[model samples]
Target: MSLFLALVLLLPSSLCHRTKAQWHTCDSGFSISATAMARNITHCRKLQTLGAELGINNYSTTPNSSTSIDVVFSALPPTPQGWIAWGVNPGRHPQMVGTRALIAFNQPSGMPVVNTYNVTADTRRGCKLEPSTIEVGVANKAANYSDETGRLTMAARLTLPPEYNVSKLNHVWQVGPRVVGTVPLAHAKTLHNFDSKETMDLESGVGHSQRHHDIGLREAHGILSVIGWGTLLPIGVIVSRYFRGSPIDTKNKWFYAHVGIQILAFSLGVAAWGIGLSLMERSGQYRAFMGHRIVGILIFCLATLQVMALWLKPKMLDKYRKYWNIYHHFVGYSLIVLIIVNIFKGYAILKPAPRWKWAYIGILIGLSCVALGLEISIWFVFLKPDDKKAQTNASDPSKTSNPN
Candidate 1:
């Protein structure tokens, strides 16, 4: 029992180690000191560790001068044959603007090679690498295998681009397993335009990294949409259909119940729709989820029209009342169907599709079964009995005889 417990305790630590192996976080820092040496290790040691002890130097404020900046990137465990890169950009994420990267990698022969590249833009294929515009020099580079520390200190003298702003200085760093080929086994982070030289940490994760989009906000939007429009819309339909004229439906009780539920749902759904619009604006990827976006718009439009119809509601005796009822019913049902379909489309677009998708599916299945049961009951009580009486009268002459 003691041995079994020990193994179980070690399981989580072992898994964590394996996970960390895929990507090691780089220690980084940024500074703006004119006196800081570009080649000395003491300067980097004095700079604070942003996350895991990475250091960077400030770009020279004096324009047209021969002044330069130093960037020091360190990997915790000496990546004997791995790679590390630091990039500078004018905007937040590296993808936003052209980035110049200073990359240092240990070759298979155990020698360090430093190179430079200009990443103009991120494409559907991958990063578009171009000839760098800045001059790069490796002032100090070393790998101590025994100490498990790999350090690269580089100096770059750049002519500030037209779009570059000193207050909005953005930087990105990455650590990869190899210098060539697809660098998928990596961790990356971007420090958006910071006004001060105070050390700041960036996020790191396994696998390729994209912009720091607000994923949590997007998830909140999804949850709100699924509950308000997806689930509650169907519930409103069921209440209006199955509960009408039942013993509990006193006076306009069914009408009030149905309208209240729908109104509440629409209010929540409108909020969700607004959130969706905000998310789209923030994501900068309007065309990616076209189907989901189109369907969502249609649902909102149809729902809005349905809500407006309540204001123009006609009495039972009006000539156009039947037409109005038909229009309202058709649009409302269509909106519900679109809401459900678009929710699944949303799930498809979500990163690492969450468990809430299954939960919504289960709710949909339950509602559908309840609707089927109601339809059967209504047919048996109202339509089937009338059809049977008509058939009997037509078939038997005695049944049709007049008592008078």
Candidate 2:
């Protein structure tokens, strides 16, 4: 009987040891240290951004009891002087504004240190992110930087409040380029940095990133806006200004072309504007983008007025024709300027790839070159003949004499 009982006890210990060894290897192709291995992490997830990975152990919660769990976070810093951070936001709507972050950085003495910070609204408004005690209880917090692999690993035992739900926890992670003193400077304002927040199921290790939800819609909005306001509308203006008396204006084709292009541009612009409204409704960042939204609305109103004025245009012989022309030219040029400004604002808000911004800049440069060449050619066409006539009269005064 004593030998049989000892065999049963030894069997469970051997199985547990085998399980621990299996989990010590992360799916991200890195191995945790022996200390983190001892945490007995049962679940691990490779995060979607920043080449991050998370591991959790003892993820248990009970009613009216504070939940305690061991967590391990790992990521490679963008630079040796950079820092890495991981956190949870317990707010009803999870975002970076209220995250309880554990930020890890190398001290001036080359020691890895982990500190907790409570990210607040002020932090978003240019306030410095200073280390502070967070609402979530963090114990046994430790960090290590590996020079060989260029990765930072942080481990902490978190004591979440009873009200904090582990099933749908919102987690955020980031890596910044440089650290000043002990504070981590801001990360890059790229799409990847903006998309680091996600909702995770601690028990099953299932999670979905915010990037997957809205990236398609955002791309659609940006493309349409660029084609309509940034490209087509400007082309339409060019046709009206330069094509009117050019060789291509045969049969008044320039007028028809301008109208057609404007109509198409307006249609696309209105669609993009509607999409922008829908996106604003779905997002919680209204305050951050308030200026962009306001400018978009103004552009829509002015463009609509321009389109409607097409029908109210005065005849070329009418006494009011000059006044109408003034209004038309003023409003059209104003719309073009506003469109360009707001397109740049959208770029800032979207924070797309650098190549995208440079592409738009190249397009603007191309358009400006075209406009400048057309202006110089028009001046030569109109002024050169007058100069010739004046020279002929100066040489032979009879050409300027009145027959009467």
Against the correct fold, how does model 1 do in TM-score? Answer: 0.58
- Model 2 residue 63 CA deviation (Å) reads 5.5
Give a tens-digit lDDT track for model 2, residues 16-47.
23111112344435445333433666666667
Top candidate when judged by TM-score against the true structure: 2
Worst 10 residues of 1 by lDDT: 190-199
lDDT of 1 by residue, 270-350 (tens): 777887898677555555567788988988888988778778889889999999988888887888879888888878776
In model 1, the runs with Cα more than 4 Å from the true position are 1-86, 92-95, 101-129, 135-169, 172-213, 352-354, 387-399, 402-404
Clashing pairs in 1: 27-52, 27-53, 27-54, 28-54, 29-54, 29-55, 29-56
* 40: Cα error in model 2, Å: 4.7
